[model samples]
Target: MSGKPGPSAAAVLPELPVTFRPVRTRVVLLTVGAGLLVVLTVVALMMPSGGAQPWGPGDRATMIITGLLIFALLAVLSRPKVVADDDGITVVNLVASRRLEWAEVVKVNLRTGDPWVYLDLTDGTSLAAMGIQPGGGRDQAVRAARQLRALAEARGTGQPGTR
Candidate 1:
């Protein structure tokens, strides 16, 4: 018999499917900016004028510019990405990225009435894969969970009922 080692378990397992969805950074930035603007406007209105105008052209311009900046930031931050495959899963956080192997994943749970997809791992950990859900509805979240489950099954690591 040949002395070569047999195929490793990883090699026989199916490759994990990889998928990604960009987060909506603009929306988040816009929401934040609007909130800040409202607060600032309220504060300006509340303060005593002391015989002076509460807001001038410069102030208005600043607020407008700042609001625009906030919108842009939100748009950028909201751009969450999802990457899944038979091997593992990956999620791009607000400013960083993380990955997990299929073996490490315990189960896939789609939170009902939630805006994102959640993964429950064997280690009693969970992760949120965002950006794929449109309108923050349940349908999209369910679809994502199915996709993750399918990927896990392909790798022979998913729960029995998940298949």
Candidate 2:
């Protein structure tokens, strides 16, 4: 046996206990992108003008650019997620990720006409939970929000697994 000692179980980090995300955000994004591409291809093929000039470089370039932009939008909108563990919670938004302890969190709520869930913090600042949106799968988002609140309360009360 080697003289080096192997890593012990005590040195390993416990897995985070909670994760919340939109149910079918990625699926909808991918489906839209693929569906757009397919429709575009079919339309291009069915163009009455059999001549090559109708589907020139300019037309192809425009389609490519439009598809790419749509995909980019999907990428941005699909980025948000929320995760919680023994330590605290991490909120990943469209363009930013913030980590905060349980004490920093005030509440999670969805306002009327709000596109997504909002996380109110103790510091008077609020973060958008873009991962939980009212569209596509409202039930899933509601469940996720409830789960997040329960997790926060459970871990924020200074008693682990007590709630």
Candidate 3:
């Protein structure tokens, strides 16, 4: 032996577990939707009103519904606990949550129409890794995906060909 130390056991061996940032698509969608709703509401309020025209039942109902929706959307967006962490990869669906181990993932695919990063599971199922989705354009999403892939590889949990 050259007496030089071999690869450190910690370096050569795969990390037993890894954690991934939870997805946040629902939160993002909800926030954008809420903002749009507020804009529309403001526009409606700004429209010229007929002289002496009282609000009708239908108009009142529409206003009430819109108000309720705005409140609900705001409430959903305010809570910051949407992200989840777990033994493997944490999944946050805004209304749903899932934890998946490395073995459960078969591959990672990024396609044009798909847009978001997707994980192909061993059971013929797939999950979206929304954390990697670009909020603005393709470049941001691609960058996020690359970072995620690098993290997975560092933990030895990435699917083959991911890097």
Candidate 4:
């Protein structure tokens, strides 16, 4: 056998069990959500008790609950994430999450202006991978898409393209 080593698979493929998520989006959404909660708490406590409407305990509770609701909504916006591992890939969007084997993904694409990556599945349906969005980080998103594309090509039945 030749003493020379062949090209390393790890060099070509991204590290497995890699996770893709929007850094800026998560930071902004979580920070803003927490900030809004603090502001709401402060406002709730500062409100006068002798006002015409008489801000009572119930009123304060309502105000805090409203703030919590808003925070919950924002938290959903920060929930998109994708985990790629030896077994398969897991896609978590705002409201849905799905796991697919490597063979299930036929392609990975992130065309210009596309909000996020889209995976063409073997079922002829495309799944939106909100975890990698250009709006949060354009260059990072592209790089992630390319990495995902490489993974699909090397590990699955996906076709490679210039996308």
Q: lDDT of each structure?
A: 0.58, 0.66, 0.52, 0.83
| TM-score for each model | 0.55, 0.67, 0.53, 0.89
Error of 2 at 69 (Å): 1.8
Best by lDDT: 4
At residue 42, candidate 1 shows an lDDT of 66
lDDT, candidate 2, equals: 0.66
Misplaced by over 4 Å in model 1 are 1-17, 20-65, 132-134, 161-163
Count of clashing residue pairs in every prediction: 23, 0, 0, 0
Candidate 4 segments exceeding 4 Å error: 1-12, 51-53
Model 1 poorest ten-residue lDDT run = 1-10
TM-score of 2: 0.67
Q: What is the C-alpha RMSD of each candidate to the true structure, in Å?
A: 10.5, 11.6, 8.8, 6.4
Quote the positional error of residue 94 for candidate 1 in Å.
2.7
lDDT tens digits, residues 1-163, model 3?
Answer: 0111223311232233432332354456566767767776665665545557755556755765786687576655433221222345665543556777656655555566664677667678888765555544666555444444444444434455532
Model 4 per-residue lDDT tens digits across residues 42-161: 899889999577789998998888889989999999999999999889999999999999988987877777889999898899999999999988888877877777787788876554
Clashing pairs in 3: none
Q: lDDT by residue for model 1 over 73-132, one digit each (tens)? A: 666567677787645678776677778887766555554455566666667777776645
